[model samples]
Each structure stands twice: as C-alpha cells, then as structure tokens.
Target: MARILALDYGVKRTGIAVTDEMQIIASGLATVATKELLIYLEGYFKSENVELVLIGEPRQMDNTASESEVYIQEFLKKFSEKFPQMQMKRVDERFTSKMAFQSMIDSGMSKKKRKDKALVDEISATIILQSYLYK
Candidate 1:
C-alpha cells in the first residue's frame, strides 16, 4: 500500500508527517519554510509513493473558521495548482498545537526542545496523521 502524508501548515513553517507503507504508523517527516513547502513536497514526492495528502484544517471552539483559514485556503489553491494529480483532503486540527505541546511534556522532552516551534509543528502533523489512521 502507498503511504499517506499529512501537513500541519503555518505561515512561517509547515510540518510534515507520513505513514508507513502499510499505513499503520504515522511519523514526522520534516518541517520546512511555508514559502518552500511546494518545492520540498516536489522533491519528497519524487522519492515516495504517497497515496493521499492530508492537510490540517484549523478551526475555533465554536466550529467557526480560524483567522488563518484564508491563508490556508490560499495555500490549498496553490497546492492544487502544483500537484493536481495528487490526492488531497482536510482533517480537523482544532487544538492540535496544544495537544502536541502536551505530548512533548508527556514524553519528558527537554524544556528547550519543547520550546522549538518547528518541532511542535512536526509533532502536530504526526498527530493529525495518527488521528486520520485511528478513524
């Protein structure tokens, strides 16, 4: 089976994660600059057989769209233009950043490491992919 890839997109950075070939386990792939995300993905896709790409959909407590939703939507448009052949979908990502931070705490990560915003984003992507696999 082909692997599944997920992204936790941000304005400054974007986190990436991918499932195993069997699609059983999700793991952090990398974090890249938001502006370079498509370029990075172009390279990764050349070497990997990704079945579908999952993008985190950030929403608010009231299920309303987040302030950054417009940016995400714009990115999505560019993503479609660049990878029209690639399958893609969106998964709810409410509280994923908080969840990722708590996960770092649970894992006993060093305070300094936990403070790494890029790492948090990567873990958030992993969580999104894992949640997709779970359901």
Candidate 2:
C-alpha cells in the first residue's frame, strides 16, 4: 500500500506529514518554504510511493469557508495541475496551530523551542494527517 502525505499550507512555510503504508501513525516529515514546495514535492513523488495528498483547509468558526479559502483554492488548482495523477483531499484545519502550541507546552518544550514556527507547522501537518486517517 502507498503512503499518504499531508500538507499544512501557510503563506511562508508549508508543513509536511506522512503516514505509513497502512495509513496509521502520522508523523511530521518537514517544513519547507512555500515557494519551494512544488519542486520539493516533485522530487518527493519521484522517490516515495505516496498515494494521496491532504491539504489543510481553513474554515470559519461557524463551519463556513474563510478568507483563506480563496488562496487555498488557487493553490489546490495549481497543485492539481502540477500533479494531475496524484489524489488530493482537503481536511478542516480550524485549530491545528493552537493545538500544536498546546501540545508543545504539554510536552515540556522550552519557550524558545515552542516559538519555532517550523515546529508548529510540523505539528499542524501531523494533525491534518491524523484527521484524514480518522475520516
């Protein structure tokens, strides 16, 4: 079975996560600059047997689309064009960042470490993957 990759797409950095072939236990993969994502993904797809891509969707508190949806929609369109054969899905990402921060605190990470945006992105990606798996 092929693995599943998840993305927590941000304006600057894009968080990445992946699950095993069985699609369990999502783990943080890396955080890359948004501008470099496509190039990086091309290499990744060439190397790994990834079957699906899950992008974090920013939704409103009332379960409606947010302003970020516009950006995400465009990104997904381009992403689909670039990886036409790859399957893509969207997962709601309402509080993944907040949850990532709280998880860092619970894990006893130092304030300096917790402040690393990359770490937050990594956790966010993991959250997205986990959500996808449960769904």
Candidate 3:
C-alpha cells in the first residue's frame, strides 16, 4: 500500500508525518519552512509513493474555521494546482498543538527540548495522523 502523509501547517513552519508503506505506524518525518513546503514535498514525492495527504484543518472550539485558515486555504489551492492528481484531505486539528506539548512532558522531554517549536509541530503532525488512523 502507498503511504499516507499528514501535515500540521503553521505560518512560519510546517510539520510532516507519514505512515509506513503498509499504511500503518505513523511517524514524524520533518519540520520544514512553510514558504519552502511545496518544494520540499515535491522532492519527497519523487522518492516516496504517497497516495493521500492529510492536511490539518484548523478550527476553533465552536467548530468555526480558524483565522489562519485563509493561509491554509491559499496553500491548499497551490498544492492542488501543483499536484492535481494527488489526493488531499483536511482533518480537524483543534488542540493538537496543546496535545503535542503535553506529550513532550509525558515522554520526559527536557524543558529546553520541549521549547523547540519545530519539534512540537512534528509531534503535532504525528498526532494528527495517529488520530485519523484510530478513527
């Protein structure tokens, strides 16, 4: 089976995660600059067989779209245009960042290490993928 990838989109950076070839075991792949995200994915797709991509959908507590969704929507349009054949889906991403932070604490990560925003993004992407898999 082809791998399924996930992204936790941020303004400055984005987190990436992917499942194994068997479509199991979601794992953190990278934290990349948001401005360079498309180029990075293009390179990655050349080496990987990703069948579907899950883009985190930022939403508020009331289920309304988040303010940052305008940015995400713009990225989505660009992505769809760049890779028209590739499939993409948006999975709700509410609280994933907070969850990722708590996860760092649970895993006994150092305070200094937990302060790394990139690490948090990567972990958030992993959590988003894992949540989708379980659901």
Candidate 4:
C-alpha cells in the first residue's frame, strides 16, 4: 500500500507526517511555513507515493469548528484541486498540542528545545496521523 500523509496546518507553520509505504508506521516529516505549503507539497508529492491525506480538524470541546475553519476550507479546496485522486480525511485535533508538549516534557527535552514550535507541531502531526491510522 502507498503511504498516507497527515498535516497539522497552522497560520504560521504547518506540521507534516507520513506513514510508511506498508501503512504501519507514522513518522514526523517536517514543518513548513504556511505560505510555502502548497509549493512544498508539490515537491513532496513528486518524491513520495502518498495515497491519502489526513488533515487535522481543530475543534472545540463541544465539537464545533474553530476560528481557523475558514482557512482550512480554503486549503481543502486547493488540496482537492491539486490532488484529486487522493482521498482526504479530517481528524479531530482537540488537545493534540497539549499532548505533544507533555510528550516532549516527559522525554526530558530542554526548555530551549521545548520552545521550538515547529518541532512541537511536527510531533502533534504525528500523533494526529497515528490516531487516524488506528481508527
């Protein structure tokens, strides 16, 4: 099976994760600036045989869409237009950031390291991907 990709999209930075071609392991890939995402994705897709995309859906505790929904919808439109053959799934991302931070802290990461939003975002994306995979 081809690999699946997951994205934790943010206004400043976007986190990326990818599954193994066998669809078993999900690993953090990279964090890209929001403005550069489409261009970056174009290159990434050229090199990787991604069969699906899982986009993190930031939701409130009440299961309502967050303020970023507009931006995500715009991205979804572009994503669908570009990768019409690939399927896209939305996975709730409630508390994923907190979980990522906790994981980093539990790993004994330094304060400086913990301040790296890109790394945190990448890890969060991995968590989101893993959640989708096991569902």
Candidate 5:
C-alpha cells in the first residue's frame, strides 16, 4: 500500500512525516528548508509511493486563519502545480507546537535538544500525521 505523508509547514522550514506501508504508524521523516521543500518532495515521491499528503492548517484560537496561512496557501498552489497527481488534504493544527514541546519534555529530551526548532517541527508533523491516522 502507498504511504501517507504529512507536513508541518513554516515560513523558514517544514517538517515531514510518513506512515508505514500499512499506514498504521506515523514517523518523523525530515525537516527541510521551505525553499527546498518541492525538491525534497519530488525526490521522495520518485522513490516512495505516497498516496496522500496531509498539510497542517494553522488557525487562530477562534478558528480564523492564522497569519502563517498566507505562506501555506502560496505553498499549496505551487505544490499542486508541481505535482498535480498528488493528493493533498489539510488537517487542523491548533496547539500542535505546544503538544510537540510537551511531548519532548515527557520523553525526557535534553533541554538543548528540546530547543531545536527542526526537531520540534518534525515532532509536530508526526503529531499531525498521527492525528489523521486516528481519525
């Protein structure tokens, strides 16, 4: 079976996650610069069979679109244009960053390690994928 991929998009960097072939477990894959995301996805898609791409949709506490949504919207347009055959969906991403941070704390990660934004991004992506899987 083709895997399901998830992304936690940011202006500077993006986190990526993927499920197993059975689509049962979500795992953090990588953190890539925003500018390199398309290239990275292109290379990954060429090697792996990804049936769907889940992108984290940032929203404010009141459910309005977040400021970051502008960047995400732009990315989505280019993403669709670059990979028209790829299926994409958006998943609500409220509190994901906070959750990721708490997860790191609960996991006993070092303070220095916990401060790594890339690691947080990757964990956030995993959380996003897991949320989708559970849904």
Candidate 6:
C-alpha cells in the first residue's frame, strides 16, 4: 500500500513524517524550510508512493481556528495546486507541541537538544500522523 505523509506546517519551517508501506507505524522524516517544502515533497514523491498528505490543523481551546490556521490554509492552497494528484487531509494539532516537549523530557534529551525547534516540529508531525492512524 502507498504510504501516508503528514506535515506540521509553520511559516519558516515545516516538519514531515511518513507511515510505513503497511501504514502501521508513523515515523519522523525531516524538518525543512517552508520555502523548500515543495522541492522536498517532489523528491520524496518521486521515490515513495504517497497516497495522502495529512496537514496539522491548529485550533484554539474553543475549537475554533487559531491564528496559525490562516498560514496553514494558505500553505495548503499552494500545496494542493502543486500536488494536484495527491490527496490531502487535516488533523487537529492541539497540544502536539507540548506533548513533543514532554516526550523529549521523557526520553532524557539534553537541554540543548530539547531546545531544538526543528526536533519539536518533527516530533509533532509524527504525533499528528500517529493520531490519524489510530483514529
């Protein structure tokens, strides 16, 4: 089966994750500059059979769109236009960042490594993919 891809989008950087061919496990793939996301995806798609792109959808405590939602929506529009053949979906991303941070602490990562924003983003993407899989 084709793999499922997930994204944790930010204005400057984006986190990426992918499920295995069997779609049973989700793993962190990479963290790329937002400007280069399309190029990265192009290269990835050329080698991997990806059936869907799951984007993290930010929301507030009230279940409404957060401020970052606008940026994500804009990115989604361009991504849809660029990869017209690929399917796309959104998964709620609430608390993923906090969970990622807690995960880092649980793993006993160094303070310096824990400060790595890219790592947090990557983990968040993985969490998003995992959530989708379990759902």
Best by lDDT: 5
Q: Give the residue spans of candidate 3 off by over 4 A.
A: none
Tens-place lDDT digits, model 2, residues 66-101: 887787788888899999999998899999999999
Return whichever of 2 and 4 wins on lDDT: 4
Q: How do the residues 15-104 of candidate 6 rate in per-residue lDDT, one tens digit apiece? A: 999999999999999999999999999999999999999999999999999998888888888888989999999999999999999999
Instruction: Answer with 4 or 6, whichever has the higher TM-score.
Output: 6
Cα displacement (angstroms), candidate 6, residue 134, comes to 1.2
Each prediction's whole-model lDDT (CA): 0.96, 0.92, 0.97, 0.93, 0.98, 0.95
Better of 1 and 5 by TM-score: 5
List, residue by residue over 27-129, the lDDT tens digit for candidate 4.
9999999889989998988998988899999998888999998899999999889878878999998888999999999999999999999999999999999
TM-score of 1: 0.98
Clashing pairs in model 6, backbone N/Cα/C closer than 3 A: none
Which segments of candidate 6 are over 4 A away from where they belong? none
Query: How do all the candidates rank in terms of lDDT, highest first?
Result: 5, 3, 1, 6, 4, 2
What's the true lDDT of residue 88 in model 2? 90
Candidate 3: clashing pairs of residues: none
Per-residue lDDT for 1-135 in model 5, tens only? 999999999999999999999999999999999999999999999999999999999999899999999999999999999999999999999999999999999999999999999999999999999999998
Give residue 87's lDDT in candidate 6 (0 to 100): 95
Off-target runs (Cα >4 Å) in candidate 4 are none
